[model samples]
Target chain A: MSASDHLIPVVVSNVVEVNPIIKRFEFKHVNGDELPAFSGGAHIVVEMLDDGTKRKNPYSLMSSPFERDQYAISVRRDDTGRGGSKFMHEQVRPGMQMKISAPVNLFALDLRARKHLMIAGGIGITPFIAQMAQADKLGVPFELHYAARSVSQAAYMDSLADRFGDHVSCYCDDQGESVDLETLLSNQPLGTHVYVCGPKGMIERVVQTATSLGWPAAHVHFEHFLAPPVGEPFEVHLAKAGIDITVGAEQSLLEAVEASGTPINCMCRGGACGQCETVVVACDGEIMHNDHWLDEEQRAAKQRIMPCVSRFRGKRLELDL
Target chain B: MTIQFKDESFRGDFTYANSPSNIPRFPFPFPEDEYMYSTNIEPHHAARAGSPFENAFDVDEHYVAEMKDRALVLADDPGRCQALPHMETAGWDFLELVMVSKARDYPDLFKLTMDGDRWHWINKPLQIDDTFTFGDSSTLPCHPMEYIGRQVQGDHAILDQRDGNLWMDAGIITAQADWSLDFDIGMNFFEWHAPVPLAHELGVFQRALKFLLTLPQGQPSRRLNWTLTVNPRLDTSPENYPKWGPDRMTVTPENIGEKVHLRVELQTFWRLPRSNAILFPIRTYLMAMNEVVTQPKWGRRLHRVMRDLRPELVDYKGLSRYHPILVEWLSQFDDGAPTSPGIFPD
Candidate 1:
């Protein structure tokens, strides 16, 4: 089947600016049927068609899983990044028809955990919104430590506090409030799982502190979808598909391949999901590894590449796409 | 369409026999004249009407007898149904998946009603009607997995995903083909499949595991696997090998058509919504050589596939005992004619 065959048609039912930077968009099935059920920490790839160009961006579903009639996602407009989020903010309006992929969870909760500790930064609070709702329904104890720029910039602060009571903790950078990762990671109960989603620095600090505090690697979880960085233009030869595509300076390798009419199954266009991993048949220059999927050893081996974000800076590069 | 439930037996008297109409729809596993280990997974979309692939869960004429046999096996050994303590939520997820799918796909045979958390389920085929809270296990008569598993055909295994691997955490497997769920519980995907010959060296499991790890919520996939069985026995498990092993030796040239059977498993994989675990259902279909030859296409292709089958696979699938006699008997059905490309009656 073609890649677009599985997309679910949806209509923008409502849009609300939660904060100056974040806008919450509610999507309902175009035919008013119940959307597919999803679990906590799941994300859907919203497909945006603009000027004959297709852009897909993964956004965490902030609505509760039980609410199947509509799905809600909070988008933090990235002015400097690719045009997907900008389209969501400016062009997208109520009654507009669009398509989105089914929910895929790369950061699902560990149900066996006795306690859950969540850390969020800015838009990172999106996934935790649904997760907190699930934890409450399951009667599992959890605590949220969320940090934003300030009270005015914090999205869903009041409603979260009002609904979750003392379980919600807000930290504002302007007020000199920051999460103490070391203190948060120390002396937690056994079987406590820590999930952190935020900026690169914040996620690294949480992971490092948890490790230094003797937490097992399995108990530490993090989700960060890296936007493909702009790189110099390069040429890639699709050996199996018998096609050649040029990775423009502004476009990702995945976009270039998709434009060539090659069926590449991708879920989370971001670097986190390994769905778009391709074998590096040959390369004359260095392979820029920017994805979170491959290990240090695999990256050094240079036999595989995550086309979503990774790039090639060489005279000749071939992929077994 | 209403189904005509068959009153038959899978053990003891061994009175199981497929009706004449059911033979054409028998999921003949060989799409070609030869078979080897390949991923071979395809989208589990609903296909041709009246075929087994037409529903999320296929309920055939043997549904009543199969459920009865499962109950007998479970009564003899409760160890067949097992679930890890941490898999309770997954069990609930599995119960919801089956109840919802069956009620929607086969409305004539099943019904489900939901009022918030309160759920009422009815199974016309099994004469079961019960109401329970959606997520509360105490509301059900047994564990959610076991409670719903008993009402469905085939054996169901709930796989838990973590640390980049799938774990066989919970399952109700009474109709298995030699594998034991009790021993396989808590084993990772590779660990449970370690005993399978040749698939690992060929990188089949690696590719399959990677695909399943990202299996989306709505799109499920399925593949077919087959083995040879002597009788229409659903409980050819290793634990009960002695009771059924001797049946293989009873096959002779005269009784090969009646005594030997071809067992095909339509294994499907689905992603659970709540727990993010995968539900694997192995639906077994049995057809005696006599019923198989009724479909000329199946008879011709089965003979060619069996005659050219790899020696390793013949031993692996336990076809060594009666392989020569069975293949020789099937040779008469093959009249040196080229069969059609796909697996369907000519």
Candidate 2:
């Protein structure tokens, strides 16, 4: 991953619509020089404009980690998701330069596993592309299970089949072909590790099934695919800054606070990482906790808030900052 | 009239009805003539050897009174009832579970109907009758958990099982004895009981978790946890420290009988059918030490337990300040007192 502290401007060198909802983009240095190298499963935060508001969206690098000439990312257009993906789909174009943070790997491949089991739902397949490449380099036995609504929705299926052949399996819900996750989890070997990235319901089901079947939690992994649900606009008071920031209906608390000149540290921006949790001084209303990082008790405490995805609907909220 | 206390906290209009039959079957908790935290997983329907109640969730004469007390607590602080965002479904599951069970158990008080994704609930006791879309939070008059919790005479929590562990995620905990729901939400079963002295060494928590994960759908299990409280107030959460903490330090022999309460929690655990979350209902019963000694055996047991309890255990139970006084007061009955509190009658 890049060690630079500042974000670098990268040009959108190429774009391809792999499916109805997914667009794969290739980014390269503006001067056409080799970009910073990143390991498998690393993601770079792309800074985009959502109707003039600054938005940072993290996208996993799908390109092989062995090279650094360009970086690849896939964005799924989710009309129902937060506005970041919508902006990436409609506004971003080739030849346009966008600011991107250094790559960071929050879902890196485990090097010690005897075998790897990769599961994906829809666009969740992006992270596994780079991970499988690393597993190949390590000569690790692996299986890639891809599930999609249909053949058309399964992005990169042909490429994966061409590369891994029988090691890749695709299940399309439209065609009535389904993967029995219980059976898949039950048949795994002793030292095998399973990685799942998908919609919330799918991830919960896979994790629960694996756990019920006695699969060790250490061997299971998952990443959330979409942002949390949005709530009404609210006002935030930064104690240290002594300013009351009005977070818009579509804006996250983290974005509003950052736009006001006090940037909070953040990683995934999807509420999966715990980097942006800020101490809440006082709250007069209920907090809609949207982070996967905090457990139920922490969410209920009202003492802390994950500014990235969490929001509130109240007159005023005070943050310790 | 509201009798105001020295701590600025006042007791609501309470009539001290001391009929032994009205005691509502306290689940004596201590087994083998000693006290220790163990897995102690018993079948939900299993009859307690000496209990006056028969069902997993037993409602007694105090149901209406306790519900009234809960309503007062909630009115003063609505933060006492919170159902996290993801727990919306579990809340509905809880609502339906109570309505259906109550409709079946006490047919006159509750009724539930289902038509596809819509449900109609009739709570005769609360005078609520409405038809709303299932799984929609807005359709309900209040948060689903609070709506049900307010009607019942117990504190309830929903624990979701994920990744081979149960998470104490959602609940309306208006009457926590000494624990804080704010600090325990989303915590695993073990983290919730970390303060217990020897549960870890005895593998009690592990055994309990295993038993809970394997608990069948309709079959609930129950266990007991007991402690001493300064008053009959149910909201003993740390958030109310300033209001109740000093009373613990000021208690003495003169008022120990009236100030000290033997608090026993009859905790019932069962799995929700729809959400698959475990529904835990904790019913608390508090009796003044003076009223308890009316039962000679119980008085002697309380005296012996308080005297022999380890110092660390007593401190952890929050009885370090006035326990010695409590022990002294119970010693008067050590040589066998009368079968009644003759001088303490209402």
DockQ of 2: 0.01
**What lDDT would each prediction earn against the true structure?**
0.90, 0.75
Model 2 error, position A149 (Å): 19
Chain A vs. true chain A, TM-score per model, equals 0.96, 0.95
Per-candidate total of colliding backbone pairs: 0, 4
Residues A213-280 of candidate 2: C-alpha lDDT, one tens digit per residue: 99888788888863655667888899998898888877788878888987576666777656676899
Clashes of 1: 0
- lDDT for A90 in candidate 1 is 96
Candidate 1's DockQ is 0.61
Q: State interface RMSD in Å for all models.
A: 1.7, 20.0
| Residue lDDT tens for model 1, A1-321 | 323348999999999998888899999999999898888899888888877777777889999987999999999888887777788999999999999988888889888889899999999999999999889988889999999999998999889999999999999999999988887788579999999999998999999999888999989999995467778899999999988899888778988888898878776778876888888998889999999889999999989999988998878899998
Candidate 1 clashing pairs, residues 3+ apart or interchain: none
